[model samples]
Target: MKQDLRAVIIDDETNAREALSNLLRLVCPEVEICGEAKNADLGIEVIKEQKPNLVFLDIQMPGKSGFDLLASFEKVDFGIIFTTAYQEFAIRAFRFSAIDYLLKPIDPDELQAAVEKYKSQTAGLNPQQIQILQQQLDTPGTVRLVNRQKNDNQRIALPTAEGIHFVQMTDIIQCESLGSYTKFHLIKGPAIVVSRLLKEYEEILDNYYFFRVHQSNIINLEHIKRYVKGDGGQVWMSDNTEIEVSRRRKEEFLSLLSDFYVNSGKLK
Candidate 1:
C-alpha cells in the first residue's frame, strides 16, 4: 500500500525543518518523520543509516549544496521533494523538467501536492532526472527533458487524469487548447488530454522545437508536414491535422522553420 511512508528532512535551517515537520504532522499523517539532518554531511549519514523512502531536501546548504549531496550518492532510490527559494529561471526549469518542488516559505497545498506525486511514483528521482535538474539550473532557458521510457517500460509524467503518458517529444504533433485543459495530438496515436493550460506547455516547450502558431495551438516544427496557403494560412501536421496559424505568428513561424531547415541542411 506504500503506507507509513518514512521520510527525512535535510535542511540547514532548524526552523525550516521544524515548520515542515509541523505541516506534515497536520496534513500528511501517513508520512513518518524518521530523521532530520542539519547539512549535507549529516544528510548523507542520515540516509545511509535510516534508509528512508523520501527526503525533503533543501537546495542551499552551508558547504555542499543539495545538488552536491545528490551527486555524491551513486544511485538515489528515495524520492526528493526540493524546498528552494530559487526564483524565476530555476522555477521555469523545474516546470519543464517535471521535477516536484515547493518554494519557500512553503505553501501547505503545494506540499500536499508534492506528497501526492511521491505516492504515485514507484521509484524516486533517478540520476538522469537529477542531471536534467542540474542542467536546467546551469542553463536556465534550455528545457531539454530526459525520460526513461523511449524503449524501457518507463512513462513521461504528464499532469492528467490518465496519469503517466508514454510519449516522446518528437512524436507529439501539436497541442490544442480546450478551455482550461490542453489536448496533445501525437503522430502515431490518439490525442491525449491534460489538465494543464496551453500557456504552461508553451513555456515548457519553448526551446524544444515547439512554437505557438496561434492562441489555440502549439505545433512541433519537426512534425509539420506542410504549410497551406492563406492570409495567415494553416499548418498541416503529420497526423493530418490542419492548425490555423495566427496572423501575428506567421512571419515568426516561417522564419524559425526556415532557420531549422537550413540548419538541418534540409533546405537545399
Candidate 2:
C-alpha cells in the first residue's frame, strides 16, 4: 500500500479552493486535502500547524502574494504546486526555481502529473540538496534558471553561448528541438542559440506558458496565433512562424490554446 500524501489549498477564492479540494478527492485519492486557507496570512499559519507534504499555492492573493509567503517561511519542508490564472511573474519564479505548478482553472490531469513528479523527485533527493533548495527559497535573488553549463550544475548569472538565453518568458515564440539541442525563437531576436536539449528546456520553462506541441517543438501559448488545419495540422506563432503539431499532442495543444485565450486578461 502507498502512503497517502497530505496537502493544503491556499487560494483567496473560496470557490477555487473548494473546487480544487473536491477534484483532489475525486481524482487523486492519494492526496489528502488536510486544510484550506483563503489568504497568505492564514495559509502560512495553517501550513505551520499542518506541516503538510505538499501545498497548492496561488500566486495572486489579497494582502501578501504567494511569493511573499514563500519568502516569509524560513524553511519549506513541503513541495509547492502553484495554481494561478496569471503566468508572467510566476513563470519567472519557476525559471529560477525547480518548483512545480499548475495553472487555473485547474486541470485534473495536470494536478495528477505534478503530484507524481513531486513523488519521483522527492523520493530520492538528497537531504543536502533539499537543504540547499530550502536556502534558495529563503534567498530573494535566487531564481530558477535552466543550467546548461557542464561546470558544477549551478544556476547561471549570465547568458553564455552555452547558458540559456534569457528571453522574456512572454516573448518566446517557440522552441524547436534539433537532436541534442533546442533552438529558441524569440519575438525581437534574430539569433538562435543551439543550447541544451528540448527535454532540458521543457523541464525548466513553466508548464503553464509552454507546451510540448510536438516531439521537436515546445510552443509558447501566449505567442500562438492559431492552429491551421492540414494533413497533420500546424501551429502558427504570433510572428507568423509555423510549426508542425504532432498528432498525439494535438488535443493537449488545443486545450492549452483555449485556456490561453480565455484567460488572456490574466497575462498582464
Candidate 3:
C-alpha cells in the first residue's frame, strides 16, 4: 500500500493556508495536513516539530520569504511545492531550476498533479539549483534573458534519471528533442539527456537567445558559426554540428539573427 504524505502549509496569509488545507482534504486523500504556519519563522518551528514529508510554501511572506525559510536549513529533507503570486521572472526561474510550484488561486487539478509528482520523484532537492532560482529572482531589469550580460553566471538544473545536472546557461550549445526526452549539447562536456519534453525548455530558453529553428532542435544564437540559405536553411554551430531550420520559421529565424548581430555590435 502507498503511504500517506504528511504535508505542512506555510504561507503569510491565514486564508491561503486554510484554503490549501481544505483543498488537500477535498482532493488529495493521501496527503495529511500535519501542520500549518503563517510566516517563515513559525514555519521553521512547525517544520522542525512536524518533520513533514512535504511542504506547501509561499514565496512571499511578512518577515522571511520562502527562500529564506529554505536557507535556514543546511539540508532540506522534505519536498517543496511553492505557491507563488510572483511575476513571470520568478516563474521562469522556477522552471530553469527544475523545481515544482503552483500559481496563486490554485487549481485543484494542478495541486493534485503536484502532489503526485512529489510522491514519484526523488526526495533530495539540489541546493545549488535552489541558489540559481534565487539569483534569477533577485536579478533586476528586463526579463528577456538575452538582454542580460553574458558573464552573469546564469545556470539551469537539468533533471535526468541519475540525478540533476546543474550547468551554466552559456555553456549550452543546443537542445535536441528525442520523443519525450531532450538532449542538451554543451560547450565543455558530454551532452546530458533529461527526461523532459523539448517544448518545456523551448519556452524558457526562447527568451535567452535560444531559438527553436526546427521542431526537434533548439540552437543558441550565440553559438551559430555560419548559416547556409536554402528552402528552410541550415546553421552550423560553434561545435561544428549542422542543424536545419524549419521552412515555416525561415523568415523569423533570419530576422532574429539580424537583431542578434546588431545588438551585439557585430553587424553595425
Best candidate (score: lDDT): 3
lDDT of 1 by residue, 84-150 (tens): 9899777766765567899989988989988987897766565555666676676544433221112
Candidate 1 segments exceeding 4 Å error? 60-63, 71-75, 116-123, 126-128, 142-167, 189-192, 255-268
Model 2 per-residue lDDT at 32: 85
Angstrom error of the Cα, residue 86, model 1: value is 1.8
Which pairs clash (backbone N, Cα, C closer than 3 Å) in model 2? 95-144, 95-145, 96-143, 96-144, 97-144
Model 3: how far residue 265 lies from native, Å: 4.5
lDDT of model 3, residue 185 = 98
After superposition on all CA atoms, how large is the RMSD of candidate 3? 2.6
Clashes of 2: 5
What is the per-residue lDDT of model 2 for residues 121-197, given as tens digits with 9 covering 90 to 100?
A: 53322233333334334443312222111112233111335433333455667878889777777778574756457
**Candidate achieving the largest TM-score:** 3
Per-model lDDT:
0.79, 0.67, 0.86
Clash pairs of candidate 1? none
Ranking under TM-score, best-scoring first? Answer: 3, 1, 2
| C-alpha-based local distance difference test score of model 2 | 0.67
Residue-level lDDT tens digits of model 3 in 87-137: 777777788888888998899999999988888875557788778778767
Q: List ranges where model 2 is wrong by over 4 Å.
A: 88-97, 123-268
